[model samples]
Target: MRIGETAAAAGMTTKTLRFYEDRGLLPATDRAPNGYRDYPHETVSRLEFIRRGRTAGLTLAQIGEILAVRDIGHAPCIHVKDLLAKQLHDLDARIAELTALRATVAEFHEAAAAGDPAACDPERICSYL
Candidate 1:
């Protein structure tokens, strides 16, 4: 299929397909007579996999490494397992930080709600914050 057709089939923009090609994530199987990129049917599934990886918060480089291992006829099971473990740990840490931030913000909101504008201290930054 041509680039536009393939992108439509994959539910992505043509520019995204071109960007993936430039990033070495998508490889074109052939070219049309007019020299436009022609993608194989497999490219659509590959694009979906890439989209899922991005949604899972994996970087393009990380996805590329996993793909490289798979392309080399390896199962990539160990690499994928290890990568997921690290990603999970990082996510847990970020979630903790976000939870703490939420608590802080709630406290600030309460303080701000109770604060009197007439009592604002000029010597310090906004006490509500």
Candidate 2:
């Protein structure tokens, strides 16, 4: 298959396919005598896997790690599990931080709402901050 056919089969744009190839996510393609890329039909499956990995919130580098393991003829399930756990842990920490920030913002908003504009000190900017 050529690049266009592969991209269509994989439901991605040609540019996206090129980007994946440039990022080392896709395997190198063979060049025809005319210098056009010739991809194997199996490249479609790999493209699908890349899309699925991105949908799961995995970074390209992380997906690359899994691909590397599989390329080496090993099952990457354990490594994928660990990566998922770390992602979940990081998400939880970010949620906690965002929750705290939301609370702080809400308090500031309430203070600003209750504050009298006339009572604001001239030397300072927004007193609510």
TM-score leader:
1
The alpha-carbon lDDT assigned to residue 1 of candidate 1 equals: 84
- Where does the lowest 10-residue lDDT sum fall in candidate 1? 67-76
- Candidate 1 local Cα displacement, residue 1, angstroms: 0.6
Clashes of each: 0, 0
User: What local lDDT does model 2 show for residue 88?
Assistant: 68
Q: What shift in Å separates residue 82 of candidate 1 from its native position after superposition?
A: 7.0
Cα-based lDDT at residue 56, candidate 1: 64
- Residues 1-129 of candidate 2 have per-residue lDDT tens digits of 889999999999999998988999998789999988999888999999999878866789978876776676755577666865776686688679889999999999998899787886788976567
Which run of 10 residues does model 2 get worst, by summed lDDT?
Answer: 67-76
* Residue pairs with backbone overlap in model 1: none
Task: Name the lDDT of candidate 1.
Answer: 0.81
Top candidate, metric lDDT: 2
Task: Give Cα-based local distance difference scores for all models.
Answer: 0.81, 0.84
